[model samples]
Target: MANIFTSSIGKKLIMSISGLFLILFLLVHLLANSAYLFGPEAFDLIIVIMGSPVVVAMVPVLAAGFAVHIAYALILNRMNMKARGAQRYEITHKGEADSWASKNMLILGLIVLGFLVFHLSHFWAKMQLPEFTGGHAENVNDLMHLTFGNPYIFVCYIVWFVALWFHLTHGFWSALQTIGMNNTKWISRLKGLSYIYATIVCGGFIVIAVTAFLRANGYIG
Candidate 1:
């Protein structure tokens, strides 16, 4: 088991599995967050359930998965850089077609990670940790209104979502390909599937954030 994780193939396998887990978690999280679009009452109820002991227990698990994913990303990127050495800049594929996101996954992932920290400070710290640490209870709707009410924060979130979309577009298919779904016949199909999946997930998040921002600005009902 230890040797498997230490090997390159094993690390890739771990990353693949962990990536899938995070994707699933994102879908569930997006669903929960989308409830906010229904209004404060519905959203608050969903938050209540999410804050329950069982859900709270899963927080560490989620955090661990995120940590592992980021760690592997850093390790793999450094290895690639070292292996490529001076040729990294000179090497270019002439006849190959690659998506913009495919070429810049690491950069996009870093942007997403940075925004995630900002997001956690604004929402998770105020809501979840407050209860655990005996601080004042955070009202879900109030937090949403306050956070999205700021034009700066709203723009920041929009930028984050854009990076997330790019990251997911490539990461989705790559995860599958890593797990042995890379047959010539299935490659194109998986790429298409990746785009669709990325669009839905990222689109859902962007809609919720933009809707809240619009509502806060009185631009929408």
Candidate 2:
């Protein structure tokens, strides 16, 4: 069991499992945010549910998952760099087609992590933090409107999602491959699935952001 954390393959396995877990987390998050499309009442209900005892209880678990994923990622990157010795510009690729995203996953992940902190400050802090602290939580729909209403914020979010798309496109399939899904037959299929999944998830967020902006500006009701 100790080897699971110390061995190279075990570390990769842990990272892959945690990565997949976070992918599922993103799907659930997207679905929850989708309620915003139905207007204030529906979104408010989601906020209530999210702040409920059960969901609130899961917060630490979710945070731990993110911590494990990020920690292992940094650890693996450091290990690779140490193994590379003097090679500074060359990046080792797994037995898949060399793509820009595959090589830059760490960079993309940092960007996503940065924006994720920014995102939590705007939404989670305002909506959930107050509830936890015995203060009044803001109206979910109004807050969404206010956050997305800014044209600059809207654009920045779009860019963040683009970085996320690239990260997902590579990370998704690579994680699967690390977990024994790699085979001659499944390789191409997994890659295709990665692209489709990334598109739908990121595209959904883009749609929500755009619609929120339009509604906030009174261009749509």
Candidate 3:
């Protein structure tokens, strides 16, 4: 176990498992967030379920998965850089066959992480923390309305969703590849699967964000 943690293959395997876990969490989160499009009542009901003791207990597990994914990425990136040394700057791709998101995963991941912090501060902290601490807010919907009612937050959410889309595009397939699913037969299929999964997850969030913005702006009934 200790050797696995210290080996390159072990780290990749850990990252792959954590990535899959986070992806599953993203699916659940997207479903919860999409309830906002159904109106305030539906959204509040979803929030209540999310804040339930069972769901609340999984929050730390999800957070740990995210932390592990990011830490492994940073470590791998550093190792790659050191191995390349001065040649890193001189290397040029030959009209790369890989997707853009795959090549720039680290950059996109960082952007997604940055926006996640902003999101937690604006929404999660206000909604979940208060309840956990035995204090109370009037209602979750009130908090949602107040937060999304702001034009700046609405724009920030849009940007965050975009970054998330890019991150998921590469991550979905890469996770599978890392787990020994890279045979030629499955490679193309996995690429298509990645796009489909990324679209569903990112599209779900975009729908919620855009719809909330429109509703808050009086553009939607």
Candidate 4:
């Protein structure tokens, strides 16, 4: 069982499972945020529900999942580099075998993580962190509006989402492939599925952010 963490295949399996968890969280997050477009009341209800006792109890578990995913990613990358030795950069078909995203996954992950730090500083720090520390809660919608209204922040977020898109485009199918879906019969199908799923997840967030920026800037009503 310990080998599961130590072995290359096991590390990947763990990474894949954890990735799926984060992806599921993204879908739920978007669903809750979508309320902002239609009704502020609906969005507020989501904020309230997420802060309810039951949901609050689950936060630590969710955070641990994220920690495990990130830790294992770094560990696996180090292991791969060690296994390849100096020949790592000499592979002729590296792109063919892995594609651009697979080669760049670590770099993409770092960018996404950095943006997440910026994101939490803007949103979670103002809302959830305050409430957790017994401070008054701010209006979530208003906070979102204020952040997106800033031209600099709005552009930064758009760029962040583009980075996220590439990360997901590679991550979606890679997870499935790690979990025994990599037979030749399903390879092409999985790659196609990756793009479709990545598009929906990333595109949903991008559209919502863009709309918020426009609304905040008075370009839209």
Q: After superposition, how far is residue 212 of candidate 1 from its true place, in Å?
A: 0.8
Q: After superposition, how far is residue 146 of candidate 3 from its true place, in Å?
A: 2.9
Backbone clashes in model 3: 0
**In TM-score terms, which candidate is top?**
2
Q: Looking at model 1, which ten-residue stretch has the lowest summed lDDT? A: 88-97
**Candidate 2 error regions (>4 Å):** 85-97
The segments of candidate 1 whose C-alpha lies over 4 angstroms from its true place after superposition are 85-97
Clashing pairs in 3: none
Poorest lDDT segment (10 consecutive residues) of candidate 2: 86-95
Candidates in order: C-alpha RMSD to true structure: 3.0, 2.3, 3.2, 2.6
TM-score of each: 0.92, 0.94, 0.89, 0.92
Residues 9-45 of candidate 3: C-alpha lDDT, one tens digit per residue = 7877887789899999899888887887777789888
lDDT of 3: 0.77
Query: Of models 1 and 2, which has the larger TM-score?
Result: 2
- Cα misplacement distance, residue 154 of candidate 4 (Å): 0.9
Instruction: Kindly list the per-residue Cα lDDT of model 4 for residues 39-145, writing each as its tens digit.
Output: 67888888999888888787787888889999998987777677664444213222224577777888989999999989988888888888789988788878878
Clashing residue pair totals per candidate (backbone < 3 A):
0, 0, 0, 0
